[model samples]
Target: MTLYYAPRTVSAAVAIALNEVGAPYETVKIDFASSDQTKPGYHKVNPKGRVPALITDRGVLTETSALLDYVAALYPKARLVPDDPFQAAQMRSVMTYLASTWHINHAMGGRGARWAYQQSSFDDLKSKVTENITANCRYFEDEVVQGPFVLGNQFTLADAYFYTVTTWLPSDGVDIADFPHLHAYQQRMQARASVQKAQSDGFF
Candidate 1:
């Protein structure tokens, strides 16, 4: 398996999941700083031109949630997803929300061009990034984070997914310290070997 990723991005979550699964894979760095992801070479791997594209014997997989779940499915022993139907649904729900909402809020802090073409419009959107991310952080602090992880003691793919977004909060003008549960959750996540490995390898 080969994972295409960029540093300090959600792509690191896939690497962490692969580590958790004890999967050996090669890393292909797509340096977004140089616009590498937009090049034609990478388009062959992911037309969407995003990070966390996984190339396996079967095929290339894009999208953070898909690749994360794929790793979990490939190695069931990792138990990245729950076995019970309801629990599994809950896990997916959180991951989906992260992709659909939290991640979007994080992206607004920098990638405004993905949404707006006009420079003034892009600036307006970018200006709201910190506020939007703060709102999302408040939601997670008050409603989402359940316990030690997204699903209490169980560490699922959702935790990995959510952890990636929390990394953006400080830059998004969110005082993580204000959210006691989330702050503690971040500490616990940082202590995980998988996360530590991903951070070290990702140069973050």
Candidate 2:
């Protein structure tokens, strides 16, 4: 069993994926409004204070990418990660794109550490983020996924990453309707029973 400390954004995907696997776990919800992640108490669990920190028998693991990968490994029977080398690479690629391009660029009301959040640099940073994510979305539309899941028909951790990042578009003012396949994919994921349960539990 593990305890996951999560926030309202990207953590949603991690929580949902874990639920999908029927993994036994508890959650500690952190309020980004008042808590300082770098403070001593939170830092003790994860020096970074980022949400989606996994406290396991081994230790606490931070970073959404690492956490999602660990979840797949911890529950192999869930088939949330690919077994083949190439497929695994593709899975990682999708997650990397989501983390590096989407989360940092568009989060925190466009006022986060990822890029210069001031007005002078905000437009430029936003443009870059939009371009990069749109390109990544196109790549996914063209090749990364087959049917609904990123790893072909098999639902993998990549789907969790996809669902998480895609959820931000509405607030970020990014239009997804242009990417029909990606939009459809999001719909498909949201329709899952496990995803519904996770949403009910407080993911949204």
Candidate 3:
């Protein structure tokens, strides 16, 4: 397998999952600093010109959630995902929220062109992006996270997904100290071997 990724981005979530699976693979860095991802060469790998595109035995798989799910499925013994149906559904819910709400809020700080083209609209979004992320984080820190992990004591795929999102907080103008539980959650994730490996691999 070959994984296309960008450092310090949500693409790291896929790297963390790949680390957990202990799979043999290669990484094709999509250097956003040089606009490499926007080039036609990369568009062939992911027509959307996004990172986190995985070359699998079957075909190329894009999207963070899909790549994570595919890795978990390919290596069931790694136990990246929960076995129980309800727990699995809860995991999906958390991932969906992070992708749909939390991530979008963070993106608003700099990528508002996705919604409106006006510079004023972009500035408006930048002003409130931090607050939006914090509010949604409050929901997750309180309403979700029932135990040590999202699925009680068991570590699920959601942990990797959520942890990756948390990485953007500090850069998103969020002082994680305001979210103690979430801060501790970040610490726990950082202590994991997989996360440590991702760090060493420069996935950050």
Candidate 4:
């Protein structure tokens, strides 16, 4: 069994992806609010002190992107990652876009907002983040097919990660109303059985 340390929200996507594969795993919630990540013993599990670290039979896996891929590969019959080379590439691209692009934007935007709250002039930086996020949102909005998932009709890990991050838009002051397709995608993703199970299991 795998030991998953996830703090409810950010880690929800990975938890859902694992559930999508029907893999057996044990989950341990890390309370980020109380600085549980920085606690003394936790570092040994993940030196970076981050949430969603998976302690598998092989070893400890950090980074959601890596963890998702690892778990998906463990259950090929689930088809969480496409079999076709091109479709697999597209799925990976979407996952990378979510992990590196959108996730980074959120980290920076949150910091900028905090700086602004501290009387720092983060206006310019925040504006740029907003613009970048909007551009991505628009791109996804226009690019996502009317199918049920991110990579067409198949439910891949990309959709799970996208749903997790895109939900942060409102808090970051991003109005996704203009991105109808993306919004619809978000709604559809949240309704998935794996997603719902992940949520119920508190895999965040």
Q: In terms of lDDT, which candidate is stronger, 1 or 2?
A: 1
Of models 3 and 4, which has the larger TM-score?
Answer: 3
Task: State the weakest 10-residue window (summed lDDT) of model 1.
Answer: 195-204
Q: In model 3, state the lDDT of residue 76.
A: 98
- Per-model lDDT: 0.88, 0.77, 0.88, 0.76
lDDT by residue (140-165, candidate 3, tens digit) is 78899776777789887888888888
- Runs off by more than 4 Å, candidate 1: none
The lDDT of model 1 is 0.88
RMSD to true structure for each model, in Å: 1.1, 2.4, 1.0, 2.9
Clashes of each: 0, 0, 0, 1
- Candidate 2 per-residue lDDT, tens place, 1-204, comes to 454554457888788778889888888777677766656877787776677788888888888889888888888999888888888898898788778766765663465445564676666666566666677677778977787687878888888878877887777666889889888988998899878877887877
What's the residue-level lDDT of 117 in candidate 3?
86
Q: Write the per-residue lDDT of candidate 4 for residues 1-204, one digit (tens) a residue.
A: 565465445678887887787777787777777878888878888888877788887889888888888878888888888899999899888888888777777766655754455534566556677778887787887785446788888888787788888778886778877777777777887788888887678663
- Candidate 4 backbone clash number: 1
Give the clashing pairs for model 3: none
For candidate 2, the 10 contiguous residues with the lowest summed lDDT are 108-117
Instruction: Give the Å shift of residue 86 in candidate 2.
Output: 1.7
lDDT of 1 by residue, 1-204 (tens): 999998888888898899888999999999888999999999999999988899999999999999999999999998999899998999998889899987887787688889888888877887888788878778888888898889887889998888888887777888889888899999999999999998889625
In angstroms, the error of model 2 at 105 is 2.8
